[model samples]
Target: MDETVTAVIDDVVARAAAHDADEPDRLRRWRVLEPDAGRLLWFLVQSSGARDVVEIGTSHGVSTLWLADAVRSTGGHLSSVDADPDVQDAALANLVRAGLDAHVTFGTGDGGAALAGLDEQSVDLLFLDAERTEYPGWWPHPVRVLRPGGVLVVDNAFSHADEVAPLAALIDEHPGLTSTTVAVGKGELLALRSR
Candidate 1:
């Protein structure tokens, strides 16, 4: 990340932190990914050399920016999905400000629908940070869309353990993937499809 991009990210993180702190209702908060988690996303994309990446949520685009930068580094592309058009707009603006808008494609509507629209075994990396309860129902899509050797990352594993438990269990039991948890930021649950 360049100094300019770093500055933009720092601004976004600070603003999001303030928003989260000021908002009394959890549902109304920005709920941006922690900076550590953002760095993890960047690392995963660079290390895996992921070319076609999908992100299930775009809240203010903190995670999206991190993923977009990584894709920019790899000369890849990121497809980001968010149910709320307004939030997606905010994310888009952030990406543009960071000069990373060119690296991303925004999908506004149901995250499941967006995932369903993708071709089978096409994506190199899939990141899930949307509504937790919906994850179990979105299964097989993640299973189907990820190419062999693809990566799956779900955020808030430890912070929202109960909410993400069922999906975690599903991933754990999948015969074709190996899974583990990383205690970063909100805690990330990572899995890789067998090559």
Candidate 2:
């Protein structure tokens, strides 16, 4: 990331933190990804040379910005999904401010619907940071769309353990996936599909 991008990310992170603090209801807040996790996403996209990236949650676009920035360098693209149009708008504005909007496509709808529409085994990286409870219902799509050797990253693994455990366990036990948990921001359950 360049100085300009770094500045933009810092600004967004500050704004999101304030927004989240002011919102009493957790659902109403913009739960931005931690900087370290965002950087990890950026590095993964670039190092893997991922040409197709999908992000399930785009709160304030902090994670989207990081992904898009990485894809910009790799000549790839990022598709970000969020159910809330207003949140997606905020994310889009942030992306535009960072000059990374061109690298992303926004989808405002049910994440499962968005995932179902993707071609089988077409995605290189799938990041899940949406509602934990809904992950189980969306399980089939993620498993179907991720190519062999593709990565699946689930956020809030440790933070919201009970809510995400079912999906995490499924991934961990799946015959086609090799999975592990990492103590990053909120914890991340990472998996790679068998080739």
Candidate 3:
């Protein structure tokens, strides 16, 4: 990564770490994206020229805030979904703190159901970080919603490798998508829709 990109990732990590340490409740079950994960996410968004992004998990809004920042810089918009209302509220507050409220739209409820309501091929980027075991269930909807040449980023893919086998198989069999798994911050799978 370039120096400029490195600096941005550092800044984001610093902020997230500070906030995570301050809020014990928020840190309980939440695993905020580390610096490398954040950098990869930022790179993916920028490289894909993704304007309309969807995030499946919004725990404390750290990753949400990161995505919001990318969207704001790209003059894009982010639709973030979380099942927990409290986490959603925290995410909203974090975005506001980052001065990114205008770029993000929050949906609080069942992430799968919320995503199902979106139009097919409407999302340019999809970030999955919800229930680890239910990843396959939540995987297809985002895949269907992403336009050609869009990207799908699934977190914890390797950590829950056995559970996500079906998803891994789908990615392997599907000709329209190519996937790469990176072991960063609990492992992330990046699937790009073939052009």
Whole-model Cα lDDT of every candidate shown, in order = 0.92, 0.90, 0.77
Clashing pairs in 3: none
Model 3 TM-score on a 0 to 1 scale: 0.83
lDDT of 3 by residue, 14-102 (tens): 66677667676833655666656766787778877789999988876767767877877778999988888887886676666556789
Best by lDDT: 1
What are the per-residue Cα lDDT tens digits for candidate 2 across 1-195?
887788889998898888888899999988999898888888888888998999999888989999999999999999999999999998898888889999999999988989999999999999999999999998788888999978998888889999989998888768999988888888888889886
Ranking by TM-score: 1, 2, 3
lDDT of 1: 0.92
Runs off by more than 4 Å, candidate 2: none
Candidate 3, number of clashes: 0
Q: Check candidate 2 and list the clashing pairs.
A: none
* lDDT ranking of the models: 1, 2, 3
Tens digit per residue, CA lDDT, model 1, 1-195: 887778888999999888888899986788899999999999999998999999999989999999999999999999999888888899889988999999999988888888888999999999999999999988879878999999999999999999999999999889999999999999999999995
Give candidate 2's whole-model lDDT. 0.90
Give candidate 1 regions above 4 Å deviation.
Answer: none
